[model samples]
Target: MEYRVLGKTGLRVSSIGMGGIPLQRVSEEEAERIVNLALDQGINFFDSARGYTDSEAKFGLVFRHRRNEAIIATKSMERTREGILQEVEDSLKALQVDYIDLYQLHNVKSLAILEQVLGPEGALRGLQEAKAQGKIRYIGITGHVAEVLEKAITLGEFETVQFPFNAVELGPTEKIIPLAQAHDVGMIVMKPVAGGAIPDKNLALRFLMDYPVASIIPGMDSEDQVLENAAIGRHFVPLNEEETKRLQESIKELGNTFCRRCEYCMPCPQGINIPMVFLLDGYWQRYGLKDWAQERYLAMKVLADECIECGTCASRCPYGLEIPRLIAQVHRRLGRN
Candidate 1:
């Protein structure tokens, strides 16, 4: 596997580490198989969070027997002293591990949240106490927002920072990555595929690997997905100049099929599965997995059939996506079934 230095933590993580979100939807046995396959294939770094329902708990089942084999990174968004301590204890118990390799403050969505985390009675003190007690090896901070992440790193001694770094979201490179590199802090890239919206997975890996981040973690729930992600690590070759130019061109040239996962365009008045519609739309439009995507799209219970044309989702969307139009498109394509 191609290993990169995880900045000052002095840990070498694979080019593609396992993201822990998809485990929420999978069975314990299924998660075990997927995680074990990744480890067997040289994925040592496993990232999880307390909020990802049953993810850490499911991982605990796998790690119980292979605790010494993998690097476990988990996070909590809790920003209280007692809550932080309790979260750490609960995570340790859930993972069945004595300590976490990396403990992160998850998803500091705003500058205010960042301050509250480092402020008095915040999670920072609790993290320090946990580190003092040898409960966590390193401290990391993650966020989808750029300003908050930059502010978090500027004010604290975070060893790692996780942010969305993909073809569409290059904000981190311009915002927090350089600062993290300057501070010798690791960058754990999340949503390399924009939560599975990006179709060319290999290209996505090559794109992220071009930058000097610690590693990129993509969620894998099945053996095929595990093999698919681990393949990038096993034979990782950064994009060539021409390939890079081609990728940039592709990004600029995209006519359709990309979901930012901003979730701003939510609360669809029609109960028309907007995100899921777009998700399946992306699967077909980008990956050309039409049959599978079509099947899943047809399974939606509260589908595009209910879109009342109120345009509330469109108003809420940060990207200004045409929610009603997209719902109509999904209804036309998949509503019959």
Candidate 2:
């Protein structure tokens, strides 16, 4: 696979790395196979998070046997020095590794949280302490807001920045990419396929390869996905004129009303699976899989109709999407009523 230097960290990583989110959906054996297959295909960068349930533990199972072959990166939502230090220890224990390659402050989506993390007793201090103690090699930040990330990178504290950057979500290109390039901070891209909203995975990934990103991590849980994504990196071809036009057409069709499934709008007080509802709704409305989508929607224990319009999810969403209204729409399309 094609390898690129992760900005100023100087670590060479595969252009097509694996994201850890979908690993939570697979069994331990399946996760092991998928991760091992990715490594065999020359994908060396693996990113996980403390909040992705057992994702860290699943990756640890594979990294323990082949630690040297992979560059492990994980993040925590904890914003304080004490909490982040504990998170670092927990990540090490979960990953079965002595030192983490990169540890990021998860989802610093606001200037206020950014300021808090950079404060005297914030998570940055914890990461600094971890770096000094050899607990982690480099510090990074992840979030969905371009302005927030733009500000965080200017402080010169983080070595890398990660956020959603797909054909449909082009907000990062407005300023984050240019400023990150200026600061020499590594650019790790998440949701390269728009969280499965983009049908042409190869086209979407190739589009991102056109930029100066360190890695484009597409979440994979199956072996076929591993091979497909890895092949794109190995061949490394730019989009032709016709292919570019096709991608543009796809983007125009997608518009900006869809959810990217970043899960920032989560933990609905009513226990609604907000992203899943939107995902199924996408399948029904966009993909014309009404029966299929409706079946899954019916199976959900906490349906979109359960949403109480508390607006908690909307408040947390980085995109400022009207989540309650969207959930109600999903119920109209998929609910039994």
Candidate 3:
């Protein structure tokens, strides 16, 4: 596979890495097969999160033996020093690895949240401590909001920055990508296929390869997906004129229907997490993880069924999506409604 130096960290990683979200849908044996196949195909970077239930352990099963051949990365949502410290220890135990190659501040969604993490007793202190103690090699940050990520990177502490950048969700182009390139920070793209919303997988991945990114991590659950994504890295094909046109067609079809998870349409007077509900629905409808998605949807503090049809979220949505309608659709499929 073609490799690039993850900016600032100086770690060479595959152009297309393995995302750990979909692993939650597979069995232990199947997860083992999928992960090992990825490694055999020369996909060395594997990213997981403390919140993606057992995803770290599933990776640990294979990484334990192939530790030297893999670059393991994970993240936590904790904002405090103690919380992040405890989360890091838990991550190490779950991954069955002594030290993580990269540990990120998971989804720093807002400017306030970013400030909390960078403050005196924030998670940055915990990550700094872990780096000093040889528990983690480098620190990074991941989120959906370009403005928030842009603000966080200006502090000059993060070694890398990850966010959703794909054919449809093109918000990062406004400032996030330029800022990261200017600062020499590694750019790790999370939703390369727009959370499976993009129909043509190869076309979607090829679209991302055109950008100056360290890696485009597309989550894989089956062997076929692992090979398909790995082949793009191994063979390294750029999207031709026809292929680019096809990708653009798909992106146009999605239009505003795709939720970019920018979180501007938040604080639903009803307390509903608008983007999160759509995210879980994407897992069910696009990723074919109905049961897993439903489980997570039910676990949420506020669900889609709680929407009161105030139209406030829809008004705030920059994309002009019919928030209440989409919420109802997701609720029917994944919620108690």
Candidate 4:
């Protein structure tokens, strides 16, 4: 696999790092197979988060023996200094590592949350303390919102930033990326496939590889998928003009339906999270995989079928979306009615 220097940290990271979100979905044995196979392919960067449910422990099981041979990064959402300090200790014990290569603020969602982390007694102070104590190398932050992430960069000196970047979400490439680059920050991409929405995986990955990013973490879950992603890594192809046009067209068609998850069209009078409800809706509608995702949607007690068509959702929607109508359509499509 091709590698790039991870910004100022100077660690050589794989062009495609192993994202840890999906590790929570597999058995320990399956997770081990996937992790080892990734290492065998010369892909050494593995990222995890405490919120990912034993993902760090699963990675620890195999890599603890070869710690020096890999680069591991993990994160937590604790906003308090004491909470963050405890989180670092917990993650170290779980990952079985002396120090994390990069530790991050896990999705500081709002301006207030951002301020809390950067405040005098805030979590970033704890992160700074961890670095001084040899617990973490570089400090960073990750979030889905470009503005929030840009705000994070301005809040303090961040060593790295992990946010969504793909054919579907190029807003970062245009804005957030250049800002991070100017700040000399490492740029790692998360959800490069738009949470599995892009039908052609290699095409999606190649689009990201075209950029000068430190790495793209695509959540490798199996040996086969690892090999497939690795093969592309060895080749490192960029989409040609025709292919790029098709990919852009695909993105345009899938764009607004994809729910950037901005929480903009929110506070549905019927208590629906307009964006989240529509995100699940997109999973069922455009993907034509309702049966595959139906159980998960059904399991959510706040299913969109409860939307009352009070027009409040539409009124508050910055994008001027037809909120209640779309919710009904999605509910009917998912048979959640």
Candidate 5:
């Protein structure tokens, strides 16, 4: 696989890094197999989060032994010095590693959160402390909003910045890309396949390689996905003219207001699986999988129809999606009622 220097962190990471979200769905043995397969294929960068329910441990199951071969990265949602300090400790234990390669402030979506994390007693202080104590090697930030991420990186505190930069979400090209390049902060591209919505995964990934990003992380759970994604980096190529047009056409179909399936809007008090509902809805409406999508939607134990309309999910969403309103629309089509 191709490797690139991850900005000022000085960490050389695989161009096709492994995103940890999909690992949450797999069994411990499956996760171990997938991670090992990725390593065998030369994928060295692994990113996870404290919130991804046992994802860190799943990674630890393999990383603990292959510690030297993997560059482990994880993040936390805590915004305070004390809270983040505790999170770093927890992450260290969960990953079964003495030091994390990169620790990010998970989804600093707004100016308020940016301020809180940069303030005197904010999470940045804790990360700084962690770096000093050798718990983490470098700090990075991830978000969906370009403005907030641009501002955060401009402060020069973060060594890297991660944001969704798929063919549809081109907002980052306007400013975040240039700003990160200027500051020499590593640019990590997430949701390169638009959260599995893009049908031509190979074309979508190759399209991202055209950018100045240091790495592109597409979440993978199965061995086939690992091989497919790793091969993209091993034999990197730009999207040809016809391929670019096809990708742009797909992008046009996926207009804005589509969920990127970040899963930040989770744990509804009413127990709704918000992103999954939207995923099935996308398959039904956009992917021409009406029957298949509807079957999965029916199989869901909890669905969009159960949303309580409390608006808590929207508040947490980085995209500012109207969760209740969108969920209602999805339920109308997918809900058994």
Candidate 6:
């Protein structure tokens, strides 16, 4: 697979690295097989988070044995020095590795949180401590807001910046990408397929390959996905004119307001599965899979109509999505009388 230097850290990583979210859904054995297959195919970068349940351990199952073959990266939501230091210890134990290649400050969505982390006793202090102690090699930041990331990168504290940059979510290109490039902070592109919102996965990935980012990580859980994604990196190609047009058409269909399934609006107080509702709704509206979508929508333990209009989910969403309003629309279209 194609390898690129990850910003100032100077670590060479595969252009097509694997994301760790989907690994939570698969069995231990399955996760092992998928990770091993990815390594065999020359995919060396693997990113996970402390919040993804057992995802770190699942990767550990493979990483512990083949630690030399992978470049492990993980993040934490902890905001204080003590909490982040504990998180690093936990991550090391979970991944069965002595040192993490990259440890990011997870989801620094606002300037307030960013300030808190950069304060005297914040997470950045802990990450710096960890780096000094040899627990982590480099520090990075991940978030959904371009403006926040743009500001964070300017401080020259983080070695890399990761944010959503897909066909539909092009906001990062305006400032984050350029500023990151200017600062020599490696750019890691997340949601390359917009969490499965973009239909043409190959074309969507190919489109991102044209950019100067360090890597594009799309979450994968299966062996076929590993092979398909790895092959794209191995035989890198730019998007042809017709292919670009097709991708643009697909992007036009998915307006900016649709869900990217980042799951930040999760654990709804009312037990509603916000992202799943939108996923099914996309199928109903875009793919003409009304029947198939409706069946799954109906099977959901808590339907969209159950949403209490609490506004809690909306407040948590990084994209500023009107969760209650959009899910209400989903209920109108997908819910049964």
Inter-residue clash pairs, candidate 2: none
The Cα RMSD in angstroms, rounded to one decimal, for candidate 6 relative to the true structure is 6.2
Question: TM-score-based ranking, best first?
Answer: 3, 4, 2, 6, 5, 1
In order, candidate lDDTs are: 0.82, 0.91, 0.92, 0.82, 0.88, 0.90
The local lDDT score (0 to 100) that residue 162 gets in candidate 3 is: 91
At residue 6, candidate 2 shows an lDDT of: 92
Better of 3 and 5 by lDDT: 3
lDDT per residue as tens, model 6, 1-337: 8999999999999999998988877899999999999999999999999987899999999998999989999999999999999999999999999999999999897799999999999999999999999999999999986668989999999999999888877778888888999999998998888767899999989899888998999989799999999999999999999999999998777664788666778889889988889878976775455776888899999998888888989999887789899999899999977
- Per-residue lDDT of 4 in model 4: 92
Best by the lDDT measure: 3
- Encode model 4's per-residue lDDT on 192-249: one tens digit a residue: 8887878788889998998889989888767899999888887897899998887777
For model 5, give the RMSD to the true fold: 6.4
Candidate 4: give the clashing pairs. Answer: none
lDDT tens digits, residue span 1-337, model 3: 9999899899999999999988988999999999999999999999999989999999999988999999999999999999999999999999998999999999998899998999999999999999999999999999988888998778899999999998888888889888998998999999888888889989988888888999989999999989889999988778989999998998888877778887889889999999999998998998887888899899999888888899999999998789999889989998765
Off by over 4 Å in 3: 299-301
- Candidate 6 backbone collisions, by pair: none
List ranges where model 1 is wrong by over 4 Å: 241-320, 323-337
Candidate 1 per-residue lDDT, tens place, 165-200, comes to 899877787869889888888889987876665567
Q: Rank order by lDDT, top first?
A: 3, 2, 6, 5, 1, 4
Quote the lDDT for 52 in model 3: 92
Q: TM-score, each model?
A: 0.79, 0.82, 0.95, 0.87, 0.81, 0.82
Tens digits of per-residue lDDT for model 2 on 245-288?
A: 99999877765467866677877888898878987887577545
Model 3 root mean square deviation, Cα atoms: 1.7
- Model 5 lDDT per residue over 211-239, tens place: 88999999898999999999999999998
